[model samples]
Target: MNKRIFSIGLALMLGAAYSLTAFSQVKPETLVKQRQAAMILQGKYWGPLGGMAQGKVPYDATVVARNAGFLEALSKMPWDGFAPSTKDVKSAALPAVFTDTAKFKEAQDRLQSEVSKLVAVSKGGAEAAVKAQLVATGKTCGGCHETFREKQ
Candidate 1:
């Protein structure tokens, strides 16, 4: 089989499986917890990568790819847990997250796009390119947080 064809097929199958397993009803607290946990996972990926991007840590191509992959996957999460009921729950999420749904969604899409760019550049082992993409990704995160998250 052609490698490209196989990869496309695998992606479609995985997407279908994920869509099936991702939907469920949970309490407001659970939704808040889930989003928080997902965000923490994102931080784990971003913290080290940000350090490397900012010259605080030495860059490694292998590690950058690994963390970029994690960020790509995590970018798909968290949004699902931003249920309207979760706004007033014990969370850092602001009520505007629900009230400004389209804006919130645009930020999520921007994050996803930036993370995908990071993953693409990380594959090529270009530190400069990856660093630039990392900066873009961080800005996207900040944009969403400023509007949707309460001050900590």
Candidate 2:
């Protein structure tokens, strides 16, 4: 009876340990999924806003409002997960992001600030103000991409 009880207890403990290991391993994949979603949202905002700033598309307050909201959300997203540090950044991400942490953080902060400004201007429903904000936002996007995004 004692031997059987000990075997069962050990088996349960080992199973629980294995489960914990599996749970921990799953988190990195979840973070990668989150990062991918953020990238998509970033692209959506960048495309339309860039068009408006470049005069390729007419400045539309509704579009600005919509895109600004997305940008604001993306800007506020936490840079968690295994960010490609200098040691292990994917080939796709620009090397600078891993190599120049301070510059990268500055660019990220600028993006967030500009997006916040864009949201504010969009709320006012003034075309001129919206246009100006869009231009500023585009500059921030360009600056970050130039430094951090891989040239495709």
Instruction: Give the clashing pairs for model 2.
Output: none
Using TM-score as the measure, the top candidate is 1
lDDT of 2 by residue, 8-85 (tens): 999999999999996566554565566667767788777888888888998777888888887888876635542552
Model 1 residue 44 lDDT? 88
Top lDDT hit: 1
Error of 1 at 83 (Å): 0.8
Candidate 1 — which residues are off by over 4 angstroms? 1-24
Q: Each prediction's Cα RMSD? A: 7.9, 6.9
Each prediction's whole-model lDDT (CA): 0.86, 0.75
lDDT per residue as tens, model 1, 31-138: 878888999999988888888878898988888899989989999999988887676677787878888899999999999999998888888856777888878888
Candidate 2 off by > 4 Å: 1-33, 81-91
Return the lDDT, model 2, position 8.
97
